[model samples]
Target: MQSAQQASVPQSDADRLRARAVWLYYAEGCTQSEIAGQLGINRVMVVRLLADARRRNEVRITIAAPLGDLAGMERALETRYGIGRVILAPFADPAGDPTKVIAAAAGNFISSGMKSGMTVGVGWGRTLYNALPFITGATLQDFRVVSLLGGIAAARRFNPAEFAWQFAELFQGEGFLIPAPAVVDSPETKHALLERCGLAAIFEMAGQLDMALVSCGGISQITTSYRTGHITESDRRSLVETGAVGDVLYNFIDAQGRPVEHEVNARAISVQLDQLRRTPERVLISGGREKHVALRAAILTLSPTVLISDEQSAKALLAEG
Candidate 1:
């Protein structure tokens, strides 16, 4: 009888080559050329072996981000707010600006949650604009993006229309924009536009959104609304007099999340706060000291299903409760 090693068939040669290639390439971090030389095989053959290994389920890759601190905070926020999901991004410099950090993490969360057939509603702000670069590009079918709010008068990087269009472009999807001013001259004009001037269709689309990505603007002087001149000095004083802490989609809200009585809220051309709450998945992405009050107000009002925020913001939010 032949020995066990001698009894093995010639097919084992290919298996051995594939295993060695995977080990050298992955474990030892060797270049394909180096692997080929070590195995005394052509580079093309080495590449094929590695491909075969992957196809055969012999190679597996995993990325484990150190998220212990984040996970704990996420759990705490979820438990406190009854939120469906919470993602806390780590920031090394607690005192540094949290826009980039929060945006990158929010982008990753949005991209991962996206599906082939889904309608996403987008809101405009610097945080949402900063998230554009971190989104992974893909082409999906039946993917639609709708701008939840109307456009600003001037051309700007973070306009509602621009953000919606760019987000749709990332997935090669369709974008439906509310082709009207963010704040009309009066409530009657806003009503006329929505009921008769083509904006009704956008509101109908908003009703069918699978998810919504939104941010809050604080009442502080440095807020996007203030900086962009959308909220004037008179408007600020009026809003403050009514106990407004911040706004979501230009609908100013108090600390308890009740919409403040303001003229701007009536003339605003955006989805109603009540409608936003009904969206299947509402994600609130914001951070920084300026935003903490706004974020809290948004949470009480929107009851967001998901929240993507920085470590400092998360801590402040939890402490508030």
Candidate 2:
């Protein structure tokens, strides 16, 4: 009995170590090198332990491959649309859900790219705002966050100025605001605002962004900014009649993702899509199943280099094509 007990001690210790290793590896996303250094074991040993844990069912890593389980949806859509990257947020009821997956991915991308002296232009939307929490505590260099579009419109609640300030504060960088209406009553007013010395300076800063972030407005006029009083209700009807699906940076795009021939959109004091594309990297985050069609329109029309969205949006996009 004593000899048998003695033999079981080493196995028991190994089992416990393996269990710990599995949790740290899969749950924590620790790299193999990190695991080895932390455990004071060879990297190869760490891999072996993880493999053993999996084999024994001590570590059950049930990767919920929804896009795949949903019928290879993500892969098909990525290929069809030529999207550089596509992420599907995990959620049971995606239509009624907030896009946590896209937000996390966008935050990860931003956090990884943050360094000193970089300028990042931000757009206003629920998705872009959601990404802010994930970007916290990153040691980025003295960067500046500028709003690509003016947030100070009729709605005082979802003010883009405050949003930009919060993001700049979070990143420990300077926040630059355009300090004008997102859309004016007329194109002449927009042009005049653009030529203003005060606004010109901000536009110059916005034009020179190293990186940019934006979101897509959905096709539904009901939930559109125009309908929500961000733009006049007349503007909303005009945009729909003009074939506009939604707007990006308040610039209306038609069903084919082409910019509509609207004077207001043409003169809007916001970063142009072409200018945004010229930036080294442009990240576009959009969410909601209701907005999936709009997201697809933006992807096809704007040609952003990167996209972040929830799984339902991703799956919906695949369905669109």
Best by TM-score: 1
lDDT of 1 at 9: 29
TM-score of each: 0.78, 0.72
Cα RMSD, each candidate: 13.1, 14.1
Model 2, position 257, has a per-residue lDDT of: 82
Error of 1 at 105 (Å): 0.5
User: Which stretches in model 1 have alpha-carbon errors above 4 Å?
Assistant: 1-68, 222-229
Each model's lDDT comes to: 0.83, 0.69
Which window of 10 residues has the lowest lDDT sum in candidate 1? 1-10
State how far residue 31 of model 2 sits from its true place (Å): 37
Roughly what TM-score does model 1 have, to 2 decimal places?
A: 0.78
Residue-wise lDDT of candidate 2 within 243-283, one digit each (tens)? 88887888788877888987768657788777776777777
